[model samples]
Target: MDHEDSARFAFLHAAPVIGGAALLKLPPLLGALGDGLRGPLLAGSVAAFVAAYLAPRYLARHFEHRALIPFSIYCSVVGLGSLAYFAVT
Candidate 1:
């Protein structure tokens, strides 16, 4: 397929990985944390990935030449931010 299609495909693929990991071993996590927090925690983390992946795709759809640069920047910043946030707290 095309570049946009491929990007979207990859973006969709990331979702399951995010959610699955969230659910996996999450029973004990929620057990310790409580029911109220579990849904939001998994949801928020998955949402973060979706937002990070989408920002670049949106910019690239019309921007053409400048697309990849901003996309890369967005991904790096978002990915790194997620990493740091997850690592610290």
Candidate 2:
């Protein structure tokens, strides 16, 4: 049941995930546009979105269960850095 729930809920949750990602990324995108770097910034955003979407498929095929380790490390580093910064401030 848990596995079934996860399977069913995973894709269903992607909309909010993508929306939240876009929201979080929008400020830098807007700033880039203001700085007249619109074309490169937009291209980079598209490339990033494509890579994020496709990389999982490749990772699932090659790394299977360990596919998320790198991403987890990245998130952990960012999260800890944010926590430390806030604590120091």
Candidate 3:
């Protein structure tokens, strides 16, 4: 496989795993927007997007292949971190 093929393979393998994590992370802020805090949602969503994208990117760099349990844990941990951050300050 060439570089493009290899890169595409990596991205395809990771898409759903990363997507699962990203969507979960987004809900907290998006949910809040629907309930209230509509104005700040743009900022919140951006922050969540950046974090979610970056987290899986970082994890994928280490893991290469996406394993289900680890991806789930990664999502949960990121969600918890987002919640904790919102909780604290």
Highest TM-score: give the candidate number. Answer: 1
Write the residue-wise lDDT of candidate 1 on 1-89 in tens digits: 65666666777787788678868867767796676787787887689878876765784575554446677899999999999999999
What TM-score does each of the candidates earn? 0.45, 0.42, 0.35
Higher-scoring candidate on lDDT, 1 or 3: 1
Which run of 10 residues does model 3 get worst, by summed lDDT?
59-68
Candidate 3 lDDT, tens digit per residue, 1-89? 64345545776697789678868866775674566656676776689678766765665565555545776799999999999999999
- Compared with the true structure, the alpha-carbon lDDT of candidate 3 equals 0.69
From the highest TM-score down, the ranking of the candidates is 1, 2, 3
lDDT of 2 by residue, 1-89 (tens): 44334434564477588789889977876774557767777898799778767755554455434445687799999999999999999
- What local lDDT does model 1 show for residue 31? 94
Stretch of 10 with least lDDT, candidate 2? 1-10
Q: Tally clashing residue pairs in candidate 1.
A: 0
Against the unseen true structure, what C-alpha lDDT does each candidate score? 0.75, 0.70, 0.69
By lDDT, the better pick of 1 and 2 is 1
